[model samples]
Target: MQAAISFAISLVAMSFGIAKLPLGPWERGFLALGLIFVVTSSFTLAKCVRDRQEVTEVSSRVDKARLDKLLAEHDPFETKNL
Candidate 1:
């Protein structure tokens, strides 16, 4: 929540700053487009990183479960027929 609020504040501040720039409309439009691109790219990167971490966590859990199942079925004192 805090991070979201901060992002919103920053975005608004940047927009206002860009609007106040002395540059012409075309340049301001370009800068706004660039800012939007950067924001979207950052979101995409963040989502990718989060998805990767989640996948890793899920795989680790599956591996742990497999190890536990194997251990549960293991016996130390079982007799073996040769």
Candidate 2:
């Protein structure tokens, strides 16, 4: 799924062009640079999002384990002596 989405985004960026318009050498270079920047940024942003999600999941698991440990050791109502 991620691969499909990445391909689609890159395809759209590559489709951009001064096709019929008369552009100088420098103008063409800048346009190409802009396209590259957009593609790179999209990939970078996706990675950051994935990294954050993984971190959140790990943190949640750790929290649950801590809670479980505390509950196991807790002695509510102090019913140890009869």
Q: Which of the numbered candidates is closest to the native, going by highest TM-score?
A: 1
lDDT of residue 47 for candidate 1: 100
Model 1 residue 67 CA deviation (Å) reads 0.1
CA error at residue 2 for candidate 2, angstroms = 7.7
lDDT of 1 by residue, 3-78 (tens): 9999999999999999999999999999999999999999999999999999999999999999999999999899
- Give lDDT tens digits, candidate 2, residues 5-56: 9898766656554443378878887877877788789889999999999999
lDDT of 2 at 76: 90
Q: After superposition, how far is residue 37 of candidate 1 from its true place, in Å?
A: 0.2
Q: Give the TM-score of candidate 2.
A: 0.69
Worst 10-residue stretch by lDDT in candidate 1?
71-80
